[model samples]
Target: MATKTPKNPQKKHDGRRKNLIDNKNLKSPRTGIRKWVYRFFVAIIWFLILLVPVTIYYAHDLPDISEITQPKGGSTVMVMDRSGGLLASYGDVYGDWLEFDDIPAVLVQAVIATEDRRFFDHGGFDIRGFMRAMIKNITTGRMVEGGSTISQQLAKNLFLSADKTLKRKIQELLFSAWLEMNFSKEEILTYYFNRVYFGSGAYGIDAAARIFFGHNARELSLIEAAMLAGVLKGPALYSPLRDLERSYRRMGDVLDNMVEAGFIQKSVAEKTKAENVQIVDKQTGGDERYFSDWIVERAASLIGRVNEPVIIYTTLMPDIQDKANKALQRIMDQEALTHKASQAALVSLDMDGGVRAMVGGTDYTVSQYNRAAQAQRQPGSAFKLFIYLAAFERGLSPDDVMRDSPVILKGWQPKNYSGEYLGQVTLREAFVRSLNTVAVKLAERINRKNVIEMARRLGLTTPIVAE
Candidate 1:
């Protein structure tokens, strides 16, 4: 009471002014929260405004969804022998179309586990996986992980080129969203199994199963399924045919992933990993690969661009082909080093001009040059047959005496292979001995043009210089 009595008017006014200033500066928590909420909405509005134009720009050239039902790229070319046994396949090999139910559950589980663990939970794009991949890439300072989902990969493979452009990425997102909206999860997986590329030119799960396991998709075991699923990362690089060790290691990773995803027990995964996976021997017709390659080229020439799957039944006899391969290999193994011969080719044609067996080289894996078809080698002693036939047609008897000594024609001397010449020999003796000089003399006597004409008539399409 005493202090109030002594209080000055100026002090009272100062206190009131201070209270008003404090009240003016005060703010409610709800007001601050409302302000932040307003800003968030404005930012979202701007983002949508920008995204609309960008989406439109990338969407203009989007592929038609109707085309998804049809197959794309180089069509499969299946080459079969005379007895309908598959020799080889070129281009994209697609198996029979499969529905969702037709695909093995183990295979489906393996793919889901390895490719996208959250595939079932996410709607087209996986935010959690994308974020994780982004964070991992950022931490590693490199693109060690990809943010693409199965849906996005399928969309890109089905409709777009693998261009890592911003436009392509946007298109992929849009297409994936569209796919999610239009197709069910089961349908999406069905399309994936039917269209995705597995190594070795396989375009579908069924084809991969048949190619790698020699069976249908329904027959894929846990180990086989894991191996096939692992090939999805890098088809050519991880293909068993390309690298068995790498493929096996990748299969172990896929099995581990399956265990992590709770699709299979860890013990089961371990057992499956330890089990021996029998891969179908793609080298069954390894030597015939050269023949298959030739057949494909000839087929392409006969039929323009290959736009659809085709079956080519050729005159190749598998038994004869095996024999030819063995014969060339045996010769190369036994005498190749001594003669310094690195390559050899053999071609057997039937009387009807059908190629029964063709071995392009000693080892097709090492060299694919078709010496049987592509080489332009000198006929050497082989040409003597044409000369002898021409002489026979010119009314020369086999018993007629002919000089086997060196003969000079146009300053070119022809000598026998043995380098030792018999002065005079019967035509039959010269023919049997493959005497080059005698054959040349006979050709000169009968006119060289007749020999060339005979060669042409005998199905020799190669150009021959008459000298």
Candidate 2:
């Protein structure tokens, strides 16, 4: 039996190899799983290693939370007329800072309903909302909905720019999380109301209320609150001042949202939508915006860098401004087709150099160029006044005689506007007739530099070349 059981060496080696193959097959599933697990852990560690620097880079330029009350740029510049009427506002206009408790409940509800319904429950980032918006945007093939929560919006307003970049979006998310960790929900809502920009340069709920309804935020009606909330989506697009009908339609949408969010009854929302909401008359500053704009710049120059809110009083008269606007509009409307003129500017000043009214162009909405202040043109006959004034200061009377004949200077021939010169006319007559030749001769006689000096003494800030 021992002799017969002596196996071949090759057969024994094959049997050993077969056993090794059997063991490998038995452990194949677990070994494969283990190899995958090891790769996943390595990838995870590398991701974590990369995540730290990326997060730091995004969070580096975030605004200091300590300066939450202060805006990013300069504070508002409220320009008032001499009679204490609001002419226009430049920059962000914030009202009295109201606490969370002081905010109107309906306004808060409206904002929550329209902006972020899950605002109270979210951890700064609403994954549900984000998913919904993403799905909706994907299905619709257009960005009709935004996923940013109230905290995210606040973060953007306070810290980030409006650029739609991956970095900005990531930073916004991080800042929103930071805000959520640092402040309460009520505090976030309060900051949102106070810092979020509304239309018409208004920066807070109170400012929005005053600008849109001519009242305080506490006095906001249901529909008014809904409208204000609606304006948040697109300030310039949905502004009641810019388009009341579009604004009302947006308000309806907000009211429907409020009803859907269970903030108000459907019937109540319907009634509010049906009822006419009282909004302040759209005060675009009309043509007076030119003067307001000019005065704001002037005030800024005089006051230097404005950090806090500043009230600037000016000599603009509302009534005169209206008249100027109407007159220019009428003239442009009636004669634009005939005269081939599309724009005109007017500036009326008081005797003491106070700008009472200004029409920058045919329409401020159309063209903001202030031809009265910004444009440079030949003085033409307007310069004759300075010439006569210079002569008068040199002891020449207004009634003194001057030759009104055609004259040439440097190959340039001066002619009267009427193409007929009355020879040997009195100074007053020459000025009344606007005789260019006589005015030119007077400037040459009195010295052109003296005329420039006279103009400078009279508050002419424009450069004067005596050529």
Candidate 3:
């Protein structure tokens, strides 16, 4: 009774004890919620104030809707051999412009399924898809999934660069919204198919079809469509010409996506996979491609900046190019390793000096340097051709004998290539044997200046210093 009386004294003194709730000091839940909401609305207002001017600044540069039908002042140069067959392409590839109705339904389905399954349902951005991608990227510790819809991709490709910046991303979103507002889904898809870049320097579905399958875009098979669709992720990484196995693997994934999206039956997907799609053989040309590249380099000078589609008729002979490529590759493959040579080049010209065939290197993909034209190597014994020609022109016959011994010219002793010298050899023997000592002796007899003059006259444009 005494303990209860002492504890209850303070409690009984006031109207309420300062226990769980103090009316004077405690905050009201209603008031707190109102304050938070007010701050949130104020923050939203500030965000709008900041976003409006930036949006206007970026949106001002957006291309007109009509301009999207074609690349802005861009065109492709179609390089062809003498037979009018496609050798290679240069500049911005436009390909054959395709309409929505002309494109294959399967190809469209493939693109939609693989790129954005909710393309028809979304406005411009896919919020749920973005959230999912965010979660997946965070959990996976890498960006394996992208939330960009087909509209977003089109917007980025058309209006903005591929730079991974916040400003670029905001511009992309705004442009995507603009694109969604301006065109129908079908029109967007048509623009996408006609403008997107595929691998092996191919742009647009038509170029992809022709380059990869050697067919028109309208004729893309089920497997072919899947492969083409897969290329949208990364053109070079998934290109059939770049990596066949990786390309097929991505193609299979696209097929699976198509089946899951109800665009194609599982059985059909399976059948397509089992049937094995036929990709264009990458080994069709080795050196002719170099010649094609050479033509491509000079094409702009020949035709000017390619702002429109142009067909360049080149001086390439496919058959001769193939032979030249094989010969160079054979020498590189058979003799290069044995002789410790890293590369080789071959240039075969027609009687009239038309570049019939040219091999830049053992593998054009590995090294694009055209040794026949671009390389500046000491010709070594090959320079002897000039000296011997000078000697021959100076009344020296092929049967004229020259001492095959080592000789010193101002402390520079020329040695034979074989490191051994014959006592006396004919001029023809020295020329055939590539005898360096004999070559130097012949150069001395021909008075070196004449040899350099003869080389200059024979189209040797490089500076020659007489030392």
Candidate 4:
């Protein structure tokens, strides 16, 4: 201190920081980037945590994994005769169930190729496949393909309804994931093959094989498998039974898919395409389906919801059904041009109310209305039977004479079908010749309520006007 420490003239190291003040005042671009990156990771973690609770809630409603072996029941209603002869079958027409190992390898390949090419590689959802499907559908302006995996389809068919909703889709995804975690690929595919619906009321692969090929699922040929797989796109649209041309085209598409997926070689696919499949013309063609349908609607109240196999004994006779179909066809072909009749129906019922033969319409595939039971055409002369019977019950005999002249009631004039009036006619003659004026006069005399009650007693269910 006395020498003033010979104070060496020197600058402090801390004062060098002042040289970098301008650089410190400027902000680096990476600071904001780092903050956002941290937030993004945190958001992802929160999303995963939230999904845990939602997944648990949905998992509780899912069927037990052990219950998967027993497929959800399907409706099956079998209508037969009193003699044990099968008349028709309604509801889910299923066949024998088959195990994974029992299913043919070619069929599995066909389904996987056509339905999901990345079936084995995905967990439950196929993002790449979904994206591709979206692009395709957007470009095509329609839903040309559904990117649902086999597991998802099985989940929907076994446990869910056909409602197209986001909640349902989420449930489907959850179930699909559960299926993937619990079951092997083969097991899931086996369940799918056993539960899917084919066209023509066929459910399951075995049923489809028997229904379309007249053979077991194990005996389905390669082309046949392709055709069956093709039908899965739109059961009714690509049904081989309804439209073979469309079915063939769809089969070719499936074959092409198989080739692309390496399930089959291109040459093999081409060869199979050249040799088309042969379908079995089952006896349940177009004609008997009408009877089957009519019997089903009538038996619905008696059977209720068909959950299991039910054998309903009906009074249908195949020979009679064939004869009736032929007779109706003959009549339509020969007399339609002459009588201006485009459609006709005939029902043969016994005294006990058992239907033996029924022809609903000219074609079942084209139109399903049962003319014999559904149509409400006015009975031109048939109503006269009830009117005359009602008059006879009121003490009028067939030999009684009546005026067949013009009659007007409430501004409604009833006349003969031939548009000509007879001056007088006996009740018997009026009955035989279907004289409209005489029948109206008798209805008036016997009181219209009596005629209405008589018609109601005769099983007329449609509406009747008094005027």
Q: In candidate 4, what residue range of length 10 has the lowest lDDT sum?
A: 5-14
Q: What is the overall TM-score of model 3 with all chains considered together?
A: 0.54
**TM-score of each candidate structure, all chains considered together:** 0.55, 0.56, 0.54, 0.57
Q: Across residues 299-385, which tens digit of lDDT does each residue of candidate 2 receive?
A: 644654446889888888889888988998889989999999977888889989888888877766544456788777787788888
Per-residue error for 322 in candidate 1, Å, reads: 22
- lDDT string, candidate 3, 1-467, tens digits: 45444666666656454443567677645577798998899999999999899899877776565668655456677888878899876566447888999899988999888788899999989998899889999999777889999999988776666667887888889988988998999989988898787855576899889888888898988889999999889774677865567788999999999989998899999888876767776553455666775676565434434356888897788898889878887788788878999888888888787888888778766444566766678877768889989999999999999989979999999787679989798999888998988888888887989999999988897768778
- Per residue, candidate 4 scores C-alpha lDDT tens digits across 347-439 of 988879888888988886655456777666888887888999999898989999998899888898987889987777899998998998888
Report each candidate's C-alpha RMSD, comma-separated, in the order given.
Answer: 21.3, 18.1, 17.7, 17.4
Off by over 4 Å in 3: 1-29, 32-39, 63-65, 70-93, 281-467
Candidate 1: global Cα-lDDT? 0.85
Off by over 4 Å in 1: 1-31, 71-89, 284-467
Indicate the TM-score of model 1: 0.55
What is the alpha-carbon lDDT for the whole of candidate 3? 0.81
Please give the distance, in angstroms, between residue 425's alpha carbon in candidate 3 and its true position after superposition.
54
Off by over 4 Å in 4: 1-36, 56-60, 63-65, 71-74, 78-88, 91-93, 285-467
**Residue 367 miss distance in model 2 (angstroms):** 16
lDDT of 1 by residue, 199-230 (tens): 56688899888987889888889999999999
Which scores higher on TM-score, 1 or 4? Answer: 4
C-alpha positional error of residue 377 in candidate 2 after TM-score superposition, expressed in Å: 34
